[model samples]
Target: MSHLAIIPLLLPLFTGIFLLLLREQRIYIKRTISGLSSIALIAVSTQLLCAVSDGNILVYSLSNWPAPFGIVLMADRLAALMVLTTSLLALFSLIYAMSGTDRQGRQFHILFQLQLFGLNGAFLTADLFNLFVFFEVLLLASYSLLLHGGGRKRIRSGLHFVVINVVGSSLFLFAVGILYGILGTLNMADLAVKVAHVSPENIGLVKTAGLLLFVVFALKAALLPLYLWLPTAYSQTSAPAAALFAIMTKVGAYSILRVYSLIFGNEAGPLANLLDGWLLGMALTTIIIGSFGLLGSKRLRQQVAYLVVISAGTLLTGFSLNSQAGIAAGLYYLPHTTFATAALFLLADLIVQRRDQMEDKLEAGLVITKQKFLGVMFFVLAIIASGLPPLSGFLGKFMLLRAALEHPALPYIMAIVLVNGLLTVIAMARTGALFFFAAHAVDTATNTYIKQSEPEPLKVRELLPILSLLGLCVLMTLWAGPINSYSLETANQLLDTPAYIDAVLGKEAQ
Candidate 1:
């Protein structure tokens, strides 16, 4: 289709570089540039939904180089949806962050924009090597951003994130090299074609490499056992930082989903079949573990971290179905989980900060009034996070559970997920009990800062960002049709490798 498809990637890339060139004292200009760039990015991503919704995959090759030599960027229904979700989240997060930050001044915005560039590039790039490049671009920026405020705690977590990713990046490189050496191409489309020709023995080796590579994804997605890094990092970072990060793990999940379908598909080459077979078991265990974590935890921030595991489990369960309906449900649930899980974490962060401020003030014998509006904001976010009906989170789970029940194996799995959901409801109830229902709200309510008497409980600035995000959640819930339909269609596209294979490699040899 049109080359405009690449704007999602280009806009952020140049904007980030431009910001880097600013003088040492242009924080306002930096914020302005970032804000405008973000608005432009959002606008571009939305226009794409309308442009590509009519059943066409937009492909733009970089430079004048043809398919195999130059990098290719594609805008399919799936990719556009992801880009749109990421852009909106980034925009809201930037808004929230701008209100309060002790960052690298303007550099903070630069890195944030850089991070967006990488995310957009990852979603749009058609080449496997290119995908790897984009993943690093984002990951490195994230590493820097995570430690932006310069705390020993955040730095500690940032190091873990960096070291682990370095390992994953190494593994990914090895996997790509193996794939290209075997398949003679690094283009995802090219590999999709040449994959079948590698003998059964070779396919086994390839699958081994694939699984190795997938482990990297699993680690990034914070799948069970591999999920230790998230809670600490999210907890230590700023609300906006945590909020933006909420979307990062999903990128890993998205990559794994694509790789699983593209290379192995239904034919299920050696190692791929095994992963295909065991995904349900892994998902089930992840859900059980995550729910139990939430159940055992009293802290709201910790509970939200556990919820990340819950979403991963849910997405994995959908992928495990391995059927059209199952895949469709997984695809449909991706954005819903992306929004709900991350937003909940953000809301939790905000609540905890307010509570901490009050506690500090009370210790100094200052009386403070709790803001009614902030309480209401937390209440609304809590309900949505719990997957209650009239919320998109509920509809996502509903679709997935329905899909799971249709499969014989999935019926039992769905039951477990149901239990998981109940546990989630309980964890959310605990948050409400702790924050709203307890004697604490009444006995310890305070708008005053411990150190300063004039501090307000809930400033309008703090309340509006979250409210706007919550509004988006409502819109998604109310209009699940458009999003759901596109997800289902994209799922169809994901399951069938031939169309994608043909796109990159042209027709296969007879």
Candidate 2:
């Protein structure tokens, strides 16, 4: 009922438009505007989160229109959490870009704001069709961002990224069309009501539509088979873009959780548990593939990119459990992985810049400037990324493992999760040794790495973003109990389909 629900979307929408008009004028001016806007978003999102923390579900009906007829923006705990996470991630990424990456491309700030607009809209939307609209908004902005710093590698990766997403979009439209044609509504709560009462003759089509939507969400989430494009796209993009994209896959995860738990939830009779075992199977395979990918990667960026894949799998594994504890575990793990992996991306960018010509390749290169500083940062981030003890990562995995103990596939899940963690540690250690230790070895025969003068000092500004993200991981670990309790509440709220439908559709409809 409150209007604040729409501010997250409007703020970014207007800012992006304004920045677009001011495009290429004064770089510093654009940075200031973008930075302030990002900060504002964080404030507004934080307020929204606090407002909804007490189990309040605020719905903003556009133009005073009611549900199933007009567009609506709903802010429950899950939506607020997502918006806040996106806001935080965007701000840090923008800060990193201002260090120099923004200068590498035209309209970087404009695209950044637009992507945020899309991301916020996606998280708050109450309609499936609107979800598609938001997806396109974010994807369009990401497309430009991916190619921001033009290069052959980026061009190739962007091409595949575009084609695959275009196909996904097409499938999304087709599914939406089918659902609307049959059910006569695209509003999610309305569809939930209609789906349960679907005519037997049309149940097949309904299920088809539901599964199609899953395919689109899975593609976005980067599930096993559909995730082939992620590593290359993330690795080749500019560092800031990669960091922001850390939350993009979570969008897919959010979609699956939202849609499945609502329209196709336990109340859906035949459609209940539609994604049941399917998600767990795909998630396990995704983790395995991602682990091997991390081990085999020759570049730091690619390794970080694969870590994203592994995180996605881990998240889905918890969500697929279809239990309160499991979903809570996934929600808790979500922010941890996002922040950790994003820190790694930013760290990788710094390493690449300081390595002279060696870039992020795993091979030994010239001794980087501030090797000790960067090395320590890498070591800490590595432990975090690999889910080692005493960090948010370990707590997240521990919570998930405990949750899965009651599930049927406990053995497979436990084995894969444990092995993936081990492989991640090994890969990170190896990469660290090559980049920090091996590179420092003076080729006594040739003294190739021996420099006559010390390299430039590391910039504090450039390090801020990575440190900020890592700091968040530490905070998450420090406040694990309160955070996990909140997650449990959020999960409980999510599974209460009747309440959601009642809120969106009104009590009379229910």
The number of the candidate with the highest lDDT is 2
Off by over 4 Å in 1: 102-104, 267-274, 357-369, 439-457, 508-510
For candidate 2, the TM-score is 0.98
lDDT of 2: 0.93
- Residue-level lDDT tens digits of model 2 in 266-324: 99988888998799999999999999999999899999999999999999999999899
In model 2, residue pairs whose N, Cα or C atoms come closer than 3 Å (at least 3 residues apart or on different chains), thus clashing, are none
Give lDDT: candidate 2, residue 254: 98
Please state every model's RMSD to the true fold in angstroms: 3.5, 1.3
Candidate 2 residue 390 Cα shift, in angstroms, is 0.6
Question: What is the C-alpha lDDT profile of model 1 across 283-331, one tens digit per residue?
Answer: 7888888888888764666777788778887887887787777777777
